[model samples]
Target: MQTILSVSELSKTYDSRFQALKRINLDIRRGEIFALLGPNGAGKTTLISIICGIVKASEGSVRVDGHDIVADYRAARAMIGLVPQELTTDAFESVWATVSFSRGLFGKPANPAHIEKVLRDLSLWEKKDNKIITLSGGMKRRLLIAKALSHEPEILFLDEPTAGVDVNLRRDMWQLVRSLQASGVTIILTTHYIDEAEEMADRIGVISKGELILVDDKAELMRKLGKKQMTLQLQTPLPLLPPALAAYQLELASDGNELIYTFDAQGERTGIVALLEDLNDAGIVFKDLHTTQSSLEDIFVSLMKEAK
Candidate 1:
């Protein structure tokens, strides 16, 4: 894969002497969906702002498609489109006009066909003549995406794209993202929704307290850090865990109707066979059993804690 964007030793410090980012370095592969995950004030937005030329970096550099974001601002910015977290648009302008104006901002010629295609893809064609103010919150978000695509950018930045969106609409946006990736557009996603990252990102980058903490493939991250748990439904409820089961450190659940055992999913051995044999010896019978792997949210929370 080709490196479409690169950040090297990036840092940011406001006039208040507060640092918003610190020695951040990242490389985004062309045509790959990269998810940026972090808590509030973790510098996700700052990094994106610098890359998009909205904010200046105090030190270091960023190159978008081999053009330096600072020295070659116009060429670099031309290759990227940003859907900001805020809903900032011309309230009095119609949807069509707003999207058209955005394309013009990037020095793109008037291409009504392309504009119409983007609007239709975002399900906004019916609302093209409507004023921005007449649109709902969800519709406004869609308009932002339409504007971002109006310029036909090679790299798209979606910052909290589905925030406050309904379940159905969120899934619709997910489908749209997939189609965008299929069309060879590199996507950079920043979201509070860990599930969105888990579902959409090819690689996950976690930042915290102005630092780039970790970056890895989504599956590899979960497999290496995720835990798995097995729950057995006992044929007969017990008052509590027996003393003989102390070594397993199992937990009694469902008012003693179930027993839960947790272990690393990637461990060499889970000890399930030994535990089952011991259960048979102790006359503990289970009618059924099931297992579950830890979710991305669990791993994200633990990472935040460790960073703290």
Candidate 2:
């Protein structure tokens, strides 16, 4: 994939003598969905703001589609659209009027045909003439997306796009994001929902304390760090693990009714055969057993803990 955006040695310092971002370097691939995950105040929003020209970086530089963000602000910003987390649209203005005005803000000529398509694509056509105040929360969220698409930008930044949305609306937004990607838009989103990243992102980037800790292909990251567990429901309870099973490092669960063993999913040998044979030698019976694989959320939590 081609690099759509690049950040080199980026840093941000506020008036209060606080560093919001450290020498961050990142590259966003064109036409791909990249998910940025971090805790609150992790500098995700600050990075996006800098790339979109909303905030200036204290040091280093950014290039959007090969245009310097600071030197060629207009050209760089014109290729980007931002959907902020806050709902700050004019309540008195109709959806259509607001969306149209947003397009004009980008110095783009009025194009009713494009606006109509954007509204319809967002499923906001029926509410086009309705006042923003009269729209539901989900409808308003969709309207934000419509306004962002109004300028037909090649790169879209969604800052917690589904923060307070309901489950159904979240699903709808996910579909809309995929549709946008299909239309050749590079999407960069910062979200607290791990599942959103797991389901939508081709690549995942994790930031902590203003530092870009890691960035990698989502599946590769999971395979490298993810773990798997197998739980055996013993037919008979054992107060203590046998000496023969000590090498397995099993944990007693359900008050000794179950034995849990955790191991690396990518390990060459799972040792399941040895474990079972040892169990049988020790006369430990199991009525049932189940296995589970770690998810993105598990890895995220572990990363955050490690960062701390």
Candidate 3:
């Protein structure tokens, strides 16, 4: 895949000597949905701001589609569209007028056809003539997206785009993102929603304490770090785990009615057979059993723990 955006050793520091972002390097593949995951106060927003030219970096360089962000500021910025985290809009302006004005900001000639398409795609066409103040929270969110797409940017940066949105709106926005990806738009989203990243991203990056700690293909990351657990419903309750089964490190739950064992999913030997055999030797019987794999949220939590 071709690289659409590149960052090299990017860092940010405030005048008060606070370091917001450490040395970081990243490359975004063209037409891929990349999710940046982190907790609050993480460098996710700062990194996005630097790339979008909203904030200047203390060091390092960023390139948008081979154009240096600093030296080729206009061209680099023109290739990107940002749906900010805040809902800053002209209160008195009509939806249609606001969206059109955004396009004009990029020096794009008036193209009502494109504007109409963007509005329709966002489900905001019917409210195009309505004032921004009269729209609901969800409608305003959609309007922000419409404004971003008005210039027909190649890459779109969504900063918590679905925050505070209703579930239905989130689903609709997911569908719209899929359609945009299908149209060859590279997407980079900053989200605290782990499921959002799990569902939409081809790749995932984790940032913590001003550093990019990990980045990997989503499936691959889960496979490498994910855990699997098995629960056995014991027919007979045991007062304590026998010495013979002590090596399994099993947990007693449901008042000793359930035996829980966790192990690596990718391990060559999960030791399930050994555990069951040991259970039989210990005179324990199991009526039923089930297994489950760790979710992306689990991985994120574990990573955060390790980083701390």
Candidate 4:
């Protein structure tokens, strides 16, 4: 894949001597949905701001489509659209007017048809004439997206796009994002919702304490970090784990009525068959058994903890 954006040795610091980001390096591929996951104050927004020319980096460089963000800011910024985390828009401005104004700001020639199409895609056409203050929280979010896309940017940045959104609205946004990707727009989103990344992103990047921790294809990330567990509900309540089963490293739970076995999901063999045979040799009988795969949230939590 082609690189759409690149950040090298990026760092940000305030006059108060507090560092917001530190030596971060990242490359975003064109036409990919790359999700950035991090906890609050983890520098997700600061990174986005630097890339979008909103905030100046204290050190290093950012290039959008090979144009330096600071030196060639106009052209670079013209190629990117940012839907900010906050919903700060002209209260009395009509949706259509505000969206049109945003396009004009980018020095794009007036194109009403394009504006209409963007609004319709965001489900904001019906509210195009409504004042920004009159729209619901969800509608306002959609409007923000419409405005960001007004200039037909090659790359789009969504900062917590689904925060505080209802289920239906969230699904609608997901579908809209897919449509944007289908239109060949590269998307980089910062999200706290693990499921959102799992469901939408092709690549996942974990950032913590201003450092980039890991970046991998979504499926590979899940497989590398994901685990599986088997729970056996035993028919007999053994006083403790059998010495013979010690090699399996299984845990005795539910007062010895259950045995828990954890294994790597990516392992060649889960060792279930051998464990079951050993259980039989020990005269351990299971009344029930079930297995479960770990979710993205579990993997993300484990990674963050390790980073800390």
Sequence-dependent TM-score of model 2:
0.94
Task: For model 4, name the residue pairs that clash.
Answer: none
Query: Which candidate order results from sorting by lDDT in descending order?
Result: 1, 3, 2, 4
Off by over 4 Å in 1: 233-258, 266-269
- In the range 1-308, model 3's lDDT, one tens digit per residue, is 99999999999998988899999999999999999999998889999999999999999999999999999999999999999998888899999999999999987999999999999999899999999999999999999999999999999999999999988999998999999999999999999899999999999999998999999999999989888999999898877988888888999999989999998778899899888888888889999999999989999999999999
Please estimate how well model 1 matches the true structure, expressed as its whole-model Cα lDDT: 0.95
Error of 4 at 111 (Å): 0.8
Residue lDDT tens for model 1, 110-151: 999999999999999999999999999999999999999999
Of 2 and 4, the candidate ahead on TM-score is 4
Expressed as tens digits, the lDDT of each residue in 1-308 for candidate 4 is 89999999999997888798999999999999999999999999999998988888999999998999989999999999999999878899999999999999998999999999988888889988999999999999998899899999999999999999999999999999998999999999999999999999999999999899999999998888888899999998989887899998998898988899998767888899999999999999999999999989999999988997
RMSD (Cα, Å) of model 2: 1.6
What's model 2's overall lDDT? 0.94
> How many residue-pair clashes does candidate 3 contain?
0
Q: Which number leads on TM-score?
A: 4
TM-score of 3: 0.94
What's model 4's lDDT at 262? 92
lDDT of 2 at 97: 99
Query: Mind giving the per-residue lDDT tens digits that candidate 2 earns over 1-308?
Result: 79999999999998887899999999999999999999999999999988888888999999999999988989999999999988867899999999999999997999999999999999899999999999988888889989999999999999999999999989989999999999999999999999999999999999999999999999999998888999999999989998888999999999899999998778888999889998998999999999999999999999999999
Worst 10 residues of 2 by lDDT: 262-271
lDDT of each: 0.95, 0.94, 0.94, 0.93
